[model samples]
Target: MKLHISFKISAVVLVLFAITVGMLVDVPRLDILNESIRNLFYHVTSWFAMVFLFIASFVYSIRYLNSGNEQHDLLAKIFVQVGMVFGAAGLVTGMLWAKYTWGAYWVPDPKLNGAAIALLAYLAYMILRNSLTDSLTRAKISAVYNIFAFVMMVIFVFILPRMTDSLHPGNGGNPAFSGYDLDNTMRFVFYPATIGWILLGLWISELRFRVDSLSQKMNDDLDIKSDRLDSIPRLDEE
Candidate 1:
């Protein structure tokens, strides 16, 4: 599918707007959080972007299973790869935010543990893909695994976090990014940041898909050339 020029322009504009507002907007001085609350525009948005990418990956995995189309499989894999990158970024930023707020970089928080486990599960999916040699087998098995993992990840990151106590907001009776926690000024920047990050993730995934497609085509062409060369009669035999 062709990517629209407007989409790229919009992604760029939104990202710039997010940065401008994130930095310029004044935030209330809370007890422990203080200025670190500014990370809400970045760290939280990264996970939101990761979740969006993973959902796309899950949908494409289902499409691949139904259609048996390699393109769908390629898209699913690219989305997961990009999602993993965002997940890692979220983890790092979360740790940094934690250090300032919770007085430790790596606390034994349920949400943090869940995010770590979920990321490891996806990493295992990547390893599984590399271990398989046959393309069809790899795609089919990976699609099944991807669907399962996405569901588990949702439970880990979304459901489980809410059920238990978490240093992070929106869990354990803590206020979420709604109402007073996210004021009118912060909401304007936070929502845009979430969308901007998701768009950036999609753009990155598209570029990876194109590169993979080109590499596959080049390999196919080389294989065809090799077959033709092999079929040619040997000069000595002739």
Candidate 2:
């Protein structure tokens, strides 16, 4: 769970640089986006991070099922948790952008609804895990459910949105921002922002994994001690 110092420094620097560019650099104003174009950095980048985190979660879930490694299950769980957080951030930022550009905060747009449904699918994974009592059973069943959740997310967030007309850029016949920004200045900011956010998500998940692993270890030690004490005969019994 310990991250290298280099990665820590790199994440901090990339995010700060991206923020500086996003805030200070001037972008070509489109008809609808106008000043709200700045949100592209935050909103789109958050979705990118979510995808990266969830991809990791999916891989770990499969690994857990195949290898039966507790570490893999723990990683899958933590990654999904952090991925949802970024998904929520994407939703909030997208809503703000919609308020300014689309004339409403929440629309019946396919992309918007798809994103919401994707998050709900992940929420179901959390609920399913909590409902199971046995540790091994919870890990195995949740790992299977995690695969389904990831697929549902892909369909809702990526596939369905594009299959239908969407107000979102680069989806469902909508011209992407790249077409509007003739100078392509946003590319410089957008790419770095996406990478920064992905790294930031990993950093957060790593910390959570560390805390959970330690807690599990402590709980296991206590259980062992209690079992040993119970096995010892009391004075009254003797």
Clashes of each: 0, 0
TM-score of 2: 0.92
**Residue-wise lDDT of candidate 2 within 84-188, one digit each (tens)?**
999999999999988898889998988888888888888999999899989899999999999988888788778888887788889988887778777878898
Model 1: ten consecutive residues of lowest lDDT: 229-238
Instruction: List lDDT for all candidates, in order.
Output: 0.88, 0.87
Candidate 1 per-residue C-alpha lDDT over 62-106 given as tens digits, one digit per residue, 9 for 90 to 100? 999999999999999999999999999999999998888888999
TM-score of each: 0.92, 0.92
Where is model 2 more than 4 Å wrong at Cα? Answer: 227-238
Error of 1 at 44 (Å): 0.9
